[model samples]
Target chain A: MTVLLDVRGLNVTIGGKPVCEQLDLTIEANQSWALLGRNGAGKTTLVHQLAGLRPVEAGRIRINGHDLTELSPKARAREIGVLLQHSSRGFGASVFETVLSGRHPHLSTMAWENAEDHAIAKRAIARLGLDALSERSLDTLSGGELRRVELARLLAQETSLCLLDEPMNHLDLAYQASSLDVLYQTYVAPSRAMLMVLHDPNLAYRACDHWLILLGDGHWRAGPRDSVADPALLSLTYGHPIERIDSTHGPVFMPRTSLEGAPDNHDAAD
Target chain B: MPTAQHKRILVLALFAGLVSLWLATSTGGTAIPATEVLTHLLSNDGSTHDEIVDRLRLPRALSAFAVGGLLALAGAFMQVLLRNPLGDPYILGISGGASAAVLGVMLLGLPAFWHTPGALVGALFSTLLVFGLSRGAGDWRSERLLLTGVVIAAGWSALISFVLSISPPVRLPGMLFWLMGDLGDADRPLLPLLLMSLGLAIGLLRARDLNLAARGLTQAASLGVNTARLRLELYFLGALLTAAAVATAGAVGFIGLIVPHMVRRLGGTDHRILLPAAALLGGALLVLADTAARSVISPMQLPVGVLTALLGVPTFLFLLHRRVRT
Candidate 1:
């Protein structure tokens, strides 16, 4: 396999405290890597750095061997598609208009989106099952519907590496399954890959083939699923006692109750 | 990519703008037939009302249209820059600075020629002041920029009041009339019209990137937009346009504040369709308002600034009602 994204010495700091330090990560095509971390583990920051939305400090990130900082914004956008965590509500543009904006990088100054661009945008919208809502304004959309619109935009963007921050946010159970299926079908090819920030370890384990777990205080572990998904290590990383439950399926993680303020495993999923 | 409906709106807006210019020039204190106004505009031949039509009425009407277009374009830029729907040219205190400078020139007994340059200088100075103070370390966050602009505008307001208080009683009515935004003395139409065209060109060139920017800065950056540079461009472009319009017409209010919103309500919010549509519709609206201001009381004209709201509110409500019905 070919590497799509390469990072070296990536340092993630929030409010002067380091969360991840000297982090080296390599994502290859045909692999879905789940980035697991606690609330303040700088997951969003790391994602922003990789997407080149924010300037990377004390690190080097290269997409397809081109230095992230050196690439023009349009060139870089063709390589990395970013799905932000929270889209501002009250987008005044219509669904088709917002999705069409994904073609911004592909267009030159003073040149408009051609018929091919509109057709591609329409196809992406239809893929996300939003064909009927294309003419409607985005402010009228529900959270789940809006997330679908963003996904459609990402599809229209057609970048090689997709950095998804909370792709499952605001999605229902059915939409979640359908959304991952759409992403996997489209991106898990020989020339494209994805790194998603997910909170649920069970879903991450079942959906992804690789793991990049951020332990607190500038430490992380990145490897294939079999070597990195350890019960004791996860327990240590989460600061709670995690029990590995082997059910009818292969395996899933569960946290043990300490009897004080901690809830049982069943309640933990909520 | 403008859709068919957007094209229709654009065409209608252009027609309305032309018709409005004819209406404005025809209905002033010395009334002439609309056909005669059109004939004079086209033939360029001398007639009894030749001075009134060509020299006085035509230039003033064109000035009103260009100033209105400038304010509307500036308003659209401000909305995108600050990410607020209520963004307008006057909100940045550009007009306040112009007012203070013009008042200073009057009170200081300077040559009358200094008023235009003084207003332009003051407006640009206020723009730079807001630009420098807003980006404290190095970022143009909307909340910070908006707050900084609002505070500076308040400062200009205080200065304007102080100048007003100390002014001689002889110049007070003239200054007050100027502050109310009259088009009576604004007979030079060429510069503002040229600036409007330039503004439209630059605005349309950046329209696609502007659409992405409207979503948010981070999203805009992620989608290959140079958000930082775009913010600077929008801030300065809005300031420049506002400065020119204020210099021409002494802070005409409603055209800038409400025209872009009216356009968005009629057309979609895509800047490709929004920018040109705003310029045309805003030009037409201001032309009609200025005509009404001059013609309603005949020899004695109402303040064009006050007349803008008087005409604009009813038109906006009608548009709103029609939008709901559709």
Candidate 2:
């Protein structure tokens, strides 16, 4: 299996605090990794670094055998697509126009969108079930609708690697499921890789084949789901006791609740 | 897609612009008949009507049109660069800087044409200052840039007041008239017209990326916009357009702030269409305003900028109210 993304000796700091130090990660084709972290644990920061939006303090990152630093922003965008957490609205562009802008990297600077570009954008919008809202201005869309519109843009980018930051944000349960399903269908092919920041453990567990847990204070663990999804590791990573419930389909994690005055699981374990 | 409707609006704006240009040229303090003005233009006759039409009114009308077009184009680019509806050339302090410099030149009793170079220098200085201040510690957010510009604009306004207060009484009226954006002394219109054309071309070429930029920096960059480069280009282009307009006609207001918004409301948001439409409509609107300014009181002319504000404020408010109601 050829590795599509390689990160070696990575160090990232935000606001003078070290978030990731000496981290190494390698993603092979057809692998979807879920990045799980607490608030302020730098999950979004790491994703930004991967997307080349933020500079790494010390590290080497290569996507598709090309050093990330060597590629211009346009070139980098051709191979790696990112769905940001939030984008400002009120640009007064139609949803179709906004989505079509994703084809910018593929076209020359002065070239308008050709037939293929329009077709791809249309298809992506349809995939996200936003065909009805194609002509609507971005300012009029609800939060969930806007998220889906952004998802369509991400899809239209047609990059081999996708870095999604909280991709399920502002989505209802049905939309969350449908969007994840679309992402899975589109990105789970050979020669493709996806890394997403997800808050829901069960959703991540079910949708992703690998787990990357970021413990606070620049500590992290990464491995295949079977090896890294242990209850103890999950519990320690979140700083809360997590109980795993096994269903016929898969395991679900719930926060461990204790009666008042009772010793917590961490204390009992210690 | 909807090219027919957009094309119709463009045609209508062009026709209206031609009519306004004719009206501005023919109906001034002298009030030559339209047919006589057209015959003089067509026949190249050396009559007094021909002299007035060719030498005085033509240049002034074209200057007004060029200045208005440059300002509106600059405003459109600024709005996209800052991602704010209120973004305009004046908001970036370019106009204030130019006004202060021109006032300084007047205070020194320099030749009339000296104010152009003075305004240009002041504009460049302010652009660099804002650009440098916004780049502190490698933080280049648009909101920070806008705040820096607004604060600097306020500072320039204070300096303009200082210059106005201490100026010799003899130069006060000229200074006041210039500050009110009068085009009476706008002798050279060629440079402004050329710069306006160049600005419009650049706007059209980068319209797609600008559309993406209107969303936000990260969104534009994520879609391969080379956002840093785009932002730099937009900043320089916007400053150049503002400088050209300010140099041509001192500190014209409201046209820059209002024309682009009006274009977007009437036409659409695609910068490709929005930009050309803005140029034509801005030119036409300014020509109409200048005509009203000169003819409304016959020989006693009002400053074109004052008329624009008087005309624009109510129209803008009406548009806002209607937009909200809808």
The Cα local distance difference test for each model comes to: 0.84, 0.84
TM-score of 2: 0.92
List candidate 2 segments past 4 Å from native.
A257-270, B127-154, B314-326
TM-score of chain A, predicted model 2, versus the true chain A, to 2 decimals:
0.94
On residues B230-293, what C-alpha lDDT tens digit does candidate 2 reach at each position?
A: 9888877887888788877788876877888887777468787788888988898888898888
Query: Which one wins on lDDT?
Result: 2
Question: What is candidate 2's DockQ?
Answer: 0.53
Worst 10 residues of 2 chain A by lDDT: A85-94
Q: Clashes in candidate 2: how many?
A: 0
Per residue, candidate 1 scores C-alpha lDDT tens digits across B135-175 of 67745665576577778878987887788888888877777
For model 1, what is the error of residue A103's alpha carbon versus the real structure, in angstroms, after optimal superposition? 1.0
- The complex in candidate 1 yields a DockQ of 0.70
